[model samples]
Each structure stands twice: as structure tokens, then as C-alpha cells.
Target chain A: MTAAAGTARAVWRRPPLIRNPRLRWAIYGGSLVYLVLAFASVDVNWTRVYEGLDRGLRFVEGFLVPDFVSRWGDIAQGMQESLTMTVTATVVGIMVSVPIGIGAARNIAPLPIYLACRGIIALSRSFQEIIIAILFVAMFGFGPFAGFLTLSFATIGFLAKLLAEDIEDIDEAQAEAIRSTGAGWWQVVNYGIQPQVMPRLIGLSLYRLDINFRESSVIGIVGAGGIGATLNTAMDRYEYDSAAAILILIIVIVMLAEYGSSIIRQRVQ
Target chain B: MLRLQNLTKTYRTGDRALNGVSLTVEPGQVVGLIGPSGAGKSTLIRCINRLVEPSSGQVTLGDTALTGLGHGSLRRARRRIGMIFQEYALVERLTVMENVLSGRLGYVGFWRSFFRKFPPDAVSKAYALLDRVGLSDHVDKRADALSGGQRQRVGIARALAQDPDLLLVDEPTASLDPKTSRQIMRLIVEICDERGLPAIINIHDVALAQSFVRRIIGLKSGEVVFDGAPNELTDAVLTRIYGEEDWSATIRPVDEESDDQVDDPDAEAEHHGPAEVLDRERMAGLS
Candidate 1:
């Protein structure tokens, strides 16, 4: 076989990659079986799906002819609550997370502090914002304060994790240069870590602010106070038009938040 | 005066980077450390500033004992010892002025520096240093935007900003072109001279080191094998330090012919014959 291949190489030759037909076939077959099992487990009810489609068409209609005039007062108040909660939570969360993030970064922090910060980040991130809001509402007796705390926790989890990762990836040589100058630990962070991660942190904070605003609207479902409560009430009373108005306002605000943050992110970068 | 006594460093991986090395530097003296890669040149420089902590030994800068000092005092001692890196370790996102001002981080409080409110005197000194480094107009430019040579200039200015008593330079010209390497070495020597600051420059190019430094210290296998003036760094001494490779090629000046061209056009125009013959004989003996 060697002599034949050597003699025939000038005509044509296959590259040295060996094909594995059995493994390829097994992968294809396994994917097909998993697809079938996933569909089987869905348990989608066709009759309910038809009813949902009908309801969805009605929702779309209501969305177009939203009852903005009648529920304007409630909608305006709820929006104000969400806006205040988002801003307050985001600012406080950022203030808290900067140090925590620094502590969490393995490259910068001591081992014990790094572990503790990691634990805090994990705990905050473990529960959904709604679950945390329910807990806070139960403890604090239902208000925008609960929503504020919930969003702040969520913000800390997200911002700290991302910022810490960014800090870990920064150029260590620059940090060493700072340290060699006899700068203290905080001085090293302020000069070394902060400059490298500032643009990313600002971008992340803006993004977290947008996220907290969205989450604030939803946390009101657990009596934490925002547009979600108004939305729930309008839905229960079958005031679809008023519900549509609240949703429209939320969509508009989120869109504005997204647009503004992107502009700021571009400038920062 | 700066002194390193019985300095030794063994990494966690058990690689002995520096082994019982001892040295001293007098004020305003520029000492060149030359060795093959991994012969502990960088480890020795870092040991001086305690950037890479020595496993055992004492590093005395003036009256302070740098070894075994706690975090706070180590930082205080580090402030007086300036360090330059091969990569020109400037914070890339910061402006040239900010990077230079960072040398005063040890002097300023966190709040004051955080708000970028360095003392007016520090600011003026940073400006003067930038001008001295010939980067006055590029003060507001970000460090990453500068050329390699320009960035290294900023690195030198930042080190000088500390008003350090001693400078620790690690492979200062390792990443530069021949012309740029000479320029950087010249700048370091001039600055060290003017400030009366002693400097230890870890260098790769032996000829450049000979041109700049007053004394040369050659290390082999984490030990100082040769310590004397540049004139004493003969081909045989280089072979002793770097081992049985092409020492003649390594020691022969790469571009000193250009230096003579710039000064005297006819001094050594026809003097390459004897040097070439000696180099060939050395190559034959080594083989």
C-alpha cells in the first residue's frame, strides 16, 4: 500500500485525516432522539394554544387603541416610582460593587477576601430578582423600598461579577509598575486596576441601570411597588386597554434607556 | 548607597531564579547587568524593588531594610526606588501627564489622587519631566497612542517623577530597535547622571551597555561571574559568561561604524581588517 500510494501521489492523493463514520452517525442519531424527546416533553395543548392565539389578537388590538387618557394618572405615578427605584438602586449598587468587585478579583485581592466577595456575588446572583423582591416585601411590609433593595442586589451580582472578570484580565505589568512605585494597595487599585477597567465599568453600570429599571417594573408584582402592580390590576379587571397603556409606557422607557446607554458606552469606549 | 546582600529567590515551582547574589551601587553610578536569558537578570532587578520578593536576604536602600519589611514599610521603601520595565508598563488608557503623575501615588492621599488633584508642585514637576523627556506636546495624549520609543520615554519620565534615590531598570532596551535602544540607554544614563541617582540597568545588548554604563556585572546561572569596567568585558569574558556559543559575533559592535561615520569620516575607514582576523581566529578556537 505504501509503494502504491507513493507511486500514485503525482496523480492524486487524499490528505491524512481519517474519517469516523460510526461516531458521525451516532451523533446524528443522538441529536434526532433528543429533538423528539424535547418535543414530547413540551406537552403543548393545541386547544389552549388556539385560545391563546385568539387572546393574543385581542391584546394586539388593545395595544394599538391603548386607553392612555383614562389611566394616565396611575400610569404616570407608577412610571415615576419605577424611574426613582431604578436610579436609586443603580447608584447605590455601583457604590457598593466597586469595592466588592475589587475584592473579588483574584489577581488583586487576598485569598480570604476574594473568597468572601465571590460568596456574596454568588448569593446575590442565585435568586431571581422577583424572588428577592418577595422576600424583601415580606420583611419590610410592601413598598418601593423592597423593589429598591431587590434591584440593588441584582445590580450588585451582575456588576461585580463582570467588573471583577474585567479586572482579572487587565495587564498585570501595569499593576506591577504601580506597586513598584511604593503605592499602597488602594493606591494600586485606584491607579492600576481602575484606569484599565473604568470604561468597561461605566458601560456595565449603564447597562445594569437599564436592567434594574426593567426588573423594577416586574418586582411590583410581588407588592414591591411599580408599574407591575398597576399592570396586574388592569389585567384582573379585564381593563386590557389600560394594561396596554402601561406596557406601552414601559416599552418606550426601556427603548430610551437602551438608546441612551449605548450612546454613553460608545463615548466611554 | 544601595546594597543587596546574599539575595536569593526560589519560585513556587522550585526554579531558583537568583541564588545568593550580592551587589552594591553607589550614588550616581550607572551599572549594567548583562546575561543570557533566564540567567536571573530580571529577577535581580525585581528583587531590588521587592517587586518579586526574595526568598531570603536583605535589600538595603539607604537606611531602610527592604527585605522582610511589612506591607506598609515595603511600599514606603518602594516609593524611593523607581522601576522601568521592558514593555514600558504605562497605564495605557491614561494620558501621559496622568501616567507621569502616578509616580507620586505614594506621596498623595487616595482622595486627592482619585480626584486627580495632585499638589500643584507635583503637577509642575511632572510637566518639567515631560519636557525634559522631550514629550511636552504629547502630555494630553493617551499612552497607547504613542510609538514604542515614545511610550518608553514616558516610562522613564514616570520613573524620574518619583524623585527616586535609586532606579531599577529591567531589560530597558529589549524591545527597541538598535537606534532606539541606544537613545533609551543614553536617556537613562543622562537622567541618572543629572539627578545623581544610581541605576541598575538589566541589558541584553552588551555593546549598548558598554557604551552607556560605567561598570558591567555579568551573571551566569544566577551568579555574578564577572564584575568590572566595560573595557574588561573582552570576548573571552563574554564566552565565560554566556558559554560556548559565538562570542565574537555577539561582542562585535553591530553599528558602531555608523557612530564613527557621524563624527570622523576617515579615522577607522580601513581598520576593519585586523578586527575581522581576530574574530575569525576566536571563532576557530571556540569551534
Candidate 2:
């Protein structure tokens, strides 16, 4: 036992997980205190949870045999609307983002233009897509058009920020060479900036298209038009099987989109 | 004719890259600029086309004052001046043909170039330039797919496509093997001679510069240390430019005329170690 204790003592003399023992102790003590406080402040309604157990089981049971056929018309129309919104929003968003992205890159654009484009990106990114959809629905009277506008604005923010960062990271020497050829600003962008970002741009656009589709379903809960509206209505009417069917459809479509995007990205890269 | 008066550049970081340098080059005259690293060779070459904006200077190419020209006019003036970079600087993603055609960006409009719908004459000229640079077979190949020498050829072709009055070559052979460097230098000097286009080649190898250029300008600490005929770039002048080096030991032999100096058995015997070190250093620097 003394031999074993000596070996253990030698091991303990070595460095702890953190180099500083005091800091390590402080982190451990602080986490333990926080965990205790969190456990102490717990609140629960056991009776209510017990009462809802059967309802939760019934909701889970509906997934075993989803009624996809009874609500086929609603599901199909909602999916079509979602698809349209996704396509339109992604296309318009990409088109608008390209110029704004170029303008936002500090290496390329002048200061004022860079600042303004960045301001637009920040403003759009600051709000949630559903929030934007809500505001647009109030303005445009609730439809896929409002959803389209909301997703388009969100896509612009996402795409432009990534595109600007990609532009900024490209080889400045290549652009300098173009500029030295007496090329104008537009010509420099065409020959210099565009080629470097093309593959990434293609990949990002496809990814954004996938995202806009997912967001399209969410926006419909606010009556902005899509599969979410149908899913919400079915759930409100206690048609859990129909709601399950809608969710399965969303999952399948999202999976297909993800697979498609990966294939396209591989080809481009 | 090209002229520079008191060209100076003090960068934002307070590094004075070029200090009140002045020089002139007549039409069709090929001059080599020799200097150590950070000796303002690049700054001088870039300053000619106003790529590195001079804090205070006057750059007159023929009749136009290049230093004071606005964006549009500066670009127009830049069209007449072609620059070759050390790293080739060809757009890697573009094809050789497209990269070469981009040189004519000054002449063509945005939509035309964007669609790759260059005029027939421009296309033919680009082909001719490619043929001259000996890359006619690789026109469809992407720029990044090319070897170093081939890329430099594409760079040269692109520069030539601009139809520039003056060519500014910055360390054109820095990244090339010694033999490849010689070939590239030969090609550049030959092209310049054929077209009667005046050029300024910034080179590191003094031996190469001695072989190619009739006139040499040596810069040290951003100032002109020596300016004379290539024959005048002796061991003493090199010492003045590069500082504290045994010139006779490190200096590489030039052409047949310098055979006597190179054939010195005793000097070669004494400097063999330092020569190897210099060669290793040079190779390391090149890589």
C-alpha cells in the first residue's frame, strides 16, 4: 500500500488538466456551485405531466400510420406553394446578393459603398425570417408573396455576407494584375473577382435554396402560405396522422435537397 | 520616352520604400534594374504605371503626366504600359486564351468581355501573341494547369496583347530554374528587340542582367547606388549596392568576355565554400 501510495503521489505531482491548479480548482468549484443552484431552482408540475402522458402517447402513435391520402389535395397545394416561394426567393436573392456582395468587399468596393451594403446585410440578418414574414404579411395581405419577400431578404443577408468574405479572401495579386492591364472597374470584377468566387457562389446558392425551402414551411404558420399552414390546420383539428404525413414530406424533400446540393457542390468544387 | 522626377513612396506603416528617385529611358532601350530584397525594384516598376501611388513625384510617359491622371485617364494610360509579375499573376481559373484576351480589357467593353465575345481582330492578335510565346497548343488549357515556365509565357503573351509602348517586368525569372530563367530572359530580350519596345527588367541575378541588358541601374536602400553600362557593374560597384560581400568570391561569371576573371584558380579555390552558401541561399530565396 505504501508503494502504491508513493506511485500515486508522483503522478499527482505532474500537471493537472489545467497548468494552473488554482484556476482549475476555481473552474471546478464554480461549475459545481452553478449545478447545485440550477438543481435547487427546478420547477415541475408532476400531476399535469402525468395527465398529458396519454396525449403524448397518442401523438406518437399517429406516426405509425400517417393519413397521407385523406389530405392529399391540401398537402400537394401547400408543397407547390412552398416550392414556388423557395425557387423565386432563391433566384431573386442570388441575383441581388451578387452586386451587394461585391460592393461589401472592402478589397474591391469604395468605403461608402462597402458601408452601405454591409448595413443592408446587417439589417436583414438582424431579424428572424418569420418576423420578417409577419411584417410582410401585414403589408402585402398574407400569401406566398410575403413569404417570397421574407425569404428573399433573408437569403440576401446570408449569401452576401459569405460572398463578401470569399471575395475578400481571394488573391489580391490576381486583381492587381487585372487592374494594371488598364481594365476598368467592371472589367476587373468580370475577369478578376468573378472567376475566383464562381465555384463557391454556385455551392452557396444551392445551399441557400435548400434553406429557403425549409424556411418556406416555417413561414406558413404565420399565414404566409406553404406546407406549414396545412400542417398547422391538421394539428389544430386534432388530425395528428395528417400532421405526421406533412412532417414526413418535409423531411423527404429536405433530404432530397441536401443530396442534390452535395452532388452539385462536388461537381463544382 | 519615359521620365520620372523625384519619385517617392512612404507607405502607411512609415516604411519609405522609394526615396526621391529619378531616371529616364529612351524608346527601345532595354534596362535592367538590380537590387537586393526590398530595395525598391518592385516599387519602381509599379510606380511607372502608378500601381503604387507615389506620395510625391512626376511620371511623364511621352506627353502625358501619368502621376496626376484621374481614374479613367490613368486606366487609359495604363493600357499603354504592360507589367509582368514575378509570380506570373495569370488568373488561375481562366483558360490561357481567356487570360490572354483579358489583356485587351482596356479596349473592349464590359459586356463583350463578360460574354467572351472579343472582336475577331483581338482574338487573332491574342492567338498571334500565344504563338509567339510558344503556347499555341495550350490555349484551351487552364492557367493553373500550366508549369511555371509556361505560365510565365502566358504572362508575357498577356502583357504583349495590351500593345503597350513600354513593358515593366518585375523579377520575371525569380521562381524559375536557372536554365529556365535563362530561357525566359532570352525570350523577353528577344521580344523586346523584335518589337522595338522599350523595357525595364527588374532582375536579381547580376550575371543574368550583365548578359541581357546593355544598361544597368543598381538600387540600395531605395536610392540609386549605381547607374551605368553593364560592363561597369564590376565587383566594387556590386559591393556598394549589396553591402559587405566579397564580390570576387560571390559574383558569378558572365559571358566569354569575363572568362579570364572566372578562370582564376586561386580565387575560385578560396571562395568555394561561400559560393556554395550563396548558391544555396539563392535557391532557397527563389523557392
Candidate 3:
């Protein structure tokens, strides 16, 4: 071929993630075939889908015209239990998380303490809150106490893991400056790392407070106690309106929590 | 005197940053160290405080051997040494006064420092140092709000607040403008003279180091290639330390000319963080 024709025919494209062209094309083709096979395997019954849609429309209607008066007593009691569990669990979780978070931060902690604390955080995070709630409910015989424990345990995983990551990412130069002054370990953390991470930690704690409140509502349905238990009872009786009322209350409270937390977070920053 | 006898450091990655380098700095002597990047200047300075821990060697400050100290005593010995960083590593969220007072954390108890209640002398000393560095009015301002030169001034105040015997300054002016760089160098050297304190300042700017410091030590590939008075740093010596490169522009007689007008407050307030150091090279060349 002439030089101009050869040059015109040549083309360049960005490199593929998998360097081997055959392997990359094969991978793409395999995923497309797998998607087709998976969809083919799915058994969707149109009859059941239509029934579920009809039932869902009733749910929407119940939500639109919620019955507040009939379920007001149970709703009030359940909300009170939920708020109490959320606040106490958050306070206790934060109190416990500070030490564990410090231990888990590799930059600050020794290897043994770091490993142990990381293991605790990983274990707490592995299982979903609902699973923990079920386990706690079984162990404690179905009460708000079990719900409280589940929420607190879940909070530890969430708060401590985030706090540890924040600590690890702090400015080493600032820490070095502090250490050069001959400060003790506690003093180094206070003078150097704490100031850098405090604003974020405060924001996280506020965020976690709302998360615990939300989770408390969920853990209650598994024989633990809160608004979810009230919700479960109403749902079992086919009292959609009462269930809608409980859901509305939970949403309103959660929105308020989110709004309040954001304001506080903005101020702290 | 601060002494490093055969100080060596080989990173875990098998990179030998410093190789059997040794030096002594006498009391009240200010030594400026110059080298190419990765030539072990930072490692040498950190080794004295055992901050970067010399892989195999000894660092002794006065009667105590720093390398052998346990946690408690290492801290005790460390309190006597002050460190200044290239980035002016102030606790950004803290008030300037708090950053300065943090230098006395070693002397005060945990609760006392935790509550920010320093010893009366340390507090007064911090105030005096802040005044000396011309940051007296900005003490209550957060460190992050100040200019780079101002933050470095706080770094100096913090170092002095320790009542330290020796100061290990790592690239003190690497992040500053030419004018501000000169100011900080003058301030550091002046303070060293006033306190009769020994210091090892690792500076990369050949001309700037030559202008301010009396003694100079050059490092090349982890060894001391040149150690002499600044005036003795000729073209051949520059080539030896930094490898063969045009040295005429870098090693001329000190300009001794009037500096450019002071930078505006807004310009000063802009961050001269490490990321901005590249832009400064052209400015350094012009100056």
C-alpha cells in the first residue's frame, strides 16, 4: 500500500482494561450471554404482579388518607419508645466508639490493639442490623432492651469505622510537630489529631443519631419493641390506615432529625 | 551540641536514603543543609529527634543518647528539640495562640494541656515569641485563615515556645514566595542567634541558603559531599552535590540588592502549600 493510504487506514483507540484483546472480547461476550440466560431463567408470573399492583394502589390510598385518631395511643407509645431507644443507644454507642476508634486507627495504635479493634468493627459491620436485632430479641426475650442493644451495636460499627478512617487520614506533619514537642501520646492525639478530626466526628455522630433512630424503628418488627412493633400489629390486622399513620410519623421525625443534624453540622464546620 | 555519629537510614522499600552520614552542630551554630531531592536531608534532620528513626546509627543531644531512649524518655528528650516543617504544619482548626502553646504540651500535664491551660511562663513565652515573629495581632485567628508566611511565623513561635535546645527545620521556605522566604530565613537565623540554640535547616534553594546562612553542608546520594562556609560553595562544589548542571545562575555573589515590594495581604493569604511549590521555581529564578 502507498504511504498515504496506509496512514489513512491506521487508527488508534484508548487501551482496554484487560490488555489481551481476545480475553476482553470474550469477557464482554460472556457477560452478554450470561445476562440473556439469567433473564430467561427468571419466572415472572403476570397474575401475581397484577395482584401486587392492585394491593400497592390500596397502600398508596391508605397513605393519602391516614387515620390518626384510631391508632393515636399505640402510635404515641411506640414513638416514645423509639425516640428513647435512639437517643440512649446513640449516647452509649458514641461513648464506647471513641476508645475503639482510637484503637483501630493504625497511625495512632499499636499493631495488636489496631488488629483487635478492627476485628471488632468488622464483625459488627458484617451482619445487617435486622439479623442482629433477631439474635438480640431471641436472647433477651423480645423487648425494647433487645432493640436498644441491636441499635447500639450497629452504631458502633458505623461510627467507629468512619472515625478510625478519619483519624488515619489526618495530617502526619501536624502530628510530627506535636510529637517533636515531646508531648505524651494522649497529648499528641489531643493537640494534633483531635482538632483535625473533631468537626467531621461531630458531624458523623449527629448523622449516626438519625441512623439509630431509623434503625430502632426497623429492629422493633422482629419482636424487639418500638414503632415497628406497632406497625407490625396494624399490618397483621389489615389496618392499612393505622400502619400508614405510624409510617407518616416515622418519616416526619426522620426529616426533622435530618434537618437538625445538617444545621448543627454546618455550624460545627 | 547535637551529634549524629554514622547516622544511617534504609527505608523498608530497600531505598537507602542516608548512608553512614555523620555530623556535629555546635551550640548556637546555624547550619544550612542543601541537596537534591531524595538526597537524605530530611532523613538526617528527622534522625536527630528519632522521628524517622535512623535504621542503624546514633543521635546524641547533649548528655542523653536519643536513639536509646524508651517511649517516656524519648518524649522527654524530644521536648528539648523543636521541629519546623516545609508546609508550616499548624493545627489548622486551632487558633494561632493554641498552635503556638501546643509546643509546651510536653511540659504540661495531659489535663492541663487538654483544657488549654499552659504554665504561666510558657503562655507568656508563647506571647513573646508571637510578638517577635510579628504575629501578635493574629493570635486568635485560626491557623488555616492566615497567610503561608504568617503560618510559618506561628511554626517558629511554636518551636520557640518549647524553650528547646535545638531546632530541626525541614525545608522551612520551600512553600513560601521569594520575599517571604527571605523573611522567614532571616527570622529563623536571628532567633537561633538570640537563643544561642543550635539548628539544622534543610533548604533546597541554593541561593537563598547562601544568602542567609553562614555554614553550608551539601549532600549527594546520601553522603556529605561538601561542608564549608557559604562563600566556599563554588561551581565545582555545586556540581558535586547536585550532579553536573549549569551552576552560574545558582551560585553567584549574594545580590545584596533591595527586595521587591511586600506582597499584598490577599496574595499572602493565598495558600503557598506544597502543591504551589512548582509555580514558585520561576519566581525563585527571577529573584
| Candidate that beats the other on lDDT, 1 or 3, i.e. the better one | 3
Please list, in the order the candidates appear, how each scores on TM-score for chain B only: 0.88, 0.89, 0.89
What are the runs in model 2 whose C-alpha is more than 4 Å off? A1-32, A35-53, B254-287
- Which of the predicted structures, 1 or 3, would earn the higher DockQ when compared with the native? 3
RMSD after Cα superposition, model 3: 5.4
Instruction: Estimate, for each residue in A1-269, the C-alpha lDDT of model 1 and write its tens digit.
Output: 86977764457666534368687788889999999999899988899999899889988888889999898888888888889999999999999998899899988788999999999999999999999999999999887999999998898999999999999888777888888887888888988888899999999999998888889889998899988877877888888899999998899989999999999999987
Q: Report, for every candidate in turn, its global Cα lDDT versus the true structure.
A: 0.84, 0.87, 0.86
What DockQ does each prediction reach against the true complex? 0.35, 0.40, 0.56
All candidates: CA RMSD in angstroms?
Answer: 7.6, 6.8, 5.4
TM-score of 1: 0.88
Q: What level of docking quality does candidate 2 show?
A: acceptable
Candidates ranked by DockQ, best first?
A: 3, 2, 1
Please write out the lDDT profile of model 3 over residues A1-269, one tens digit for every residue. Answer: 65767655557788879999899999999999999999999999999999999889988899999998998999899999989999999999999899999999988898999999999999999999999999998899887999999989988999999999999888777887888899998998998999999999999999999998888888888988988899999988988999999999999999999999999999988
Best by lDDT: 2
Q: Which candidate has the top score in TM-score?
A: 3
Better of 2 and 3 by lDDT: 2
Task: Give the CAPRI rating of model 3.
Answer: medium
